[model samples]
Target: MLKKAGIAIGLLSVLTGYLIHHPIPAKVPDPWLFQILTDVLAFSELMGTISERVGINRWWAYPGRLPVPRWMNVPEGMKIEKTVFHGIESVVVTPKGFAERKIPGPAIVVYHGGGWVFGNIDSYLPLLVTAAEHTGFLVMSPEYRLAPEHIFPIPFEDCLDTTLEFMSRAKEFNVDPKRIAIAGDSAGGNLAMAVTVELVKRKIAGTLVQVPAMQALIYPKLQMTNYLLPSYAQNREFIFSKDLIPKFWLSYIGLSSQYSLAQIICENAHIDFSNKQMAEKFALVHEDRVPTRYKQRPYNATPQSIPSDVKKLLDGKTKAYLNKMMLDERIAPLFASNKTLLHLPYTHVLVCEYDPLRDDGIILFERLQSLGKESSLQHLPNSLHAAASIGPFDKNLYHAKQNKILFEKVRDYLNNMH
Candidate 1:
């Protein structure tokens, strides 16, 4: 009887542990474990569903929470204020509070990236606060409408409109209108670039009076045309999988699963002739740009035809956002005309060796240099895509060191941006 009772207790413990660690997969594989691990690393104050499993008292909890507390929470050198700008929410952090900083420091309107699906201003608060402290610039990170609910053009318009409104009220926020810059990571990076293009168009049409002093794009996904880049092929199974890419794309466009997965995999639905021509021009490279090592692997050049049903779908809502001119100069910064490139401000671009977006950054850097724009490029040899955000949580000292390098580089750039 004693032996049987011990056996039962052991089985129960194992079952409970499995249940705690494994829940239903949420889009990404093993989401529950990922969330728990990320929360453990970032010191995120797990609210909502996340709080139940990993509470504040876990062994992984450290010097503070995963995200370091703000200065106001600390003994304080700066005052932080949370306010909503025209119904869009923002957290303003400055050395002297919003009232004092209302007209002096350079302003950076920041946008956080989550593939247009999941991420909030609070998730990136640590990075933002650190940026403000390091740059002595007033940073405003807006909470914009995400996808599958709001869809494309809506998010773009919201970001653009909010920026214009912010610029209009710059004096009230204590910002230097001329020194304002826009920056974001991943999807937010796409939005930032898109906003810059929109600003250029508006400026040309006499609708807008000002534009950003500079634009900082961190591992930006500039085009949807190339699904077969070496990074996409090699690192597909890395943290961000190939299967997950289409899933997010569909979510971004608010499309249901009615679109077949096979069609997307073949690039049938997304690429029309114009998109194909654009992809062939920019993504296809000469022997010089293609590393000798990458050529050993096979590449398929036979383009797949767009499916008829997909063509019909494209004619609808997605058409207006699809710019054949994106094939031209404005969209891909690397392929933009000399006139467009010359006007861009002093730029700082960071590219990671292992990141899928490395080529995009490299191409853009080369283009900027050719145009003789004052541009700075920092290539982090040991880093990977998403490394900056994951660096703090990594147990490996190497990642921690990389994070320090990234933060310092950004700090130096912002400080020197006069």
Candidate 2:
């Protein structure tokens, strides 16, 4: 059995080397190991789709969970425990000797990303450990509800609940509640955005507690209002492949099998624009706002661009439901007014140049800047979006160097905060 296992592993390694180096895939950059890995993971969506149909989609939970957290090596003396935060299950990780410290430490509430369909504390253990050790932060990660099962807004609420639980329990952990941060990658980043918007709108803990000290949105999916973004045209296969975006959304919104509704929503035409002026303003990506080269080519689309048949999906009760939710500050935080943005805490936005979500992050940062908000933007021009999650293990020369710089920058951003 040991001999057979060794041969299987050897063959897989050799295949990976050949796929990454010899011919080299396009759009996915060299150090192609990361690209190959992404491709493999992306393919799992097919299995996920089948599993969803069979009512076993949450398989990623039981098996994927059991192995990852058990194997991860955390910082020496880091106290890892499972706890309840406002009815939500969470993994609380603390730096060594945190409980005995005389002074309160900064804290971060992190969310895990799996296209909003699957991801749990176990999957994010490594990243949380890295964050805690590097930034000297007390990290709390909520085990939020996932969808196609829980549907939209439920996941956002879980995050909000956990955040408040942290705030309410801050003193017990020796954490300065006022110095807390919120962060996540991909779908988790989206939740972080919604949570920030909600906290600002609702006003919790009198003043500063509602506003986190900082937020890191790593490769977040911001707006589905437009599909003509430049990255969509350029990156057809690498990270966030063109075909999967719609499927992921279908799963998130619990409409995977509804072909017509899915088609319209996927094309960015699902929302009913009652406020035409604001909707028009938010519908398209602001060309002049982003980096110069992104404007090298022009993209033009209008409400009329999609056929009338698709728009029919917006006619009944579904339209009324989405009409309110689509513009909800939490659901489409980008639709948030400048006045709302001005009050937000310091934010660090990460954009992967080759990602479909790239334009969304860049434009968001630009908007925040125009509103005079304290914001920072980091653009990974040569790398694909969503690479942060898997980059830590890539041994390829280019992947190793760039990935290290990315995480170090993240740590520095959190650490240098005054």
Instruction: Give per-candidate clash totals.
Output: 6, 0
Q: What TM-score, computed on C-alpha atoms, does each candidate reach? A: 0.70, 0.81
| Model 1 alpha-carbon drift over 4 Å, by segment | 1-75, 96-103, 262-270, 274-338, 391-418
For candidate 2, give the lDDT of residue 299: 47
Taken over the whole model, the C-alpha lDDT of each candidate is 0.58, 0.69
lDDT, candidate 2, 329-407, per-residue tens: 6756777767667778888887776677787788888888877888888777667765665544534555445545644
Winner by TM-score:
2
Encode model 1's per-residue lDDT on 158-259: one tens digit a residue: 788788888888888777687788877777777787777667656766774788888877777665545556555544433323444454455565553323
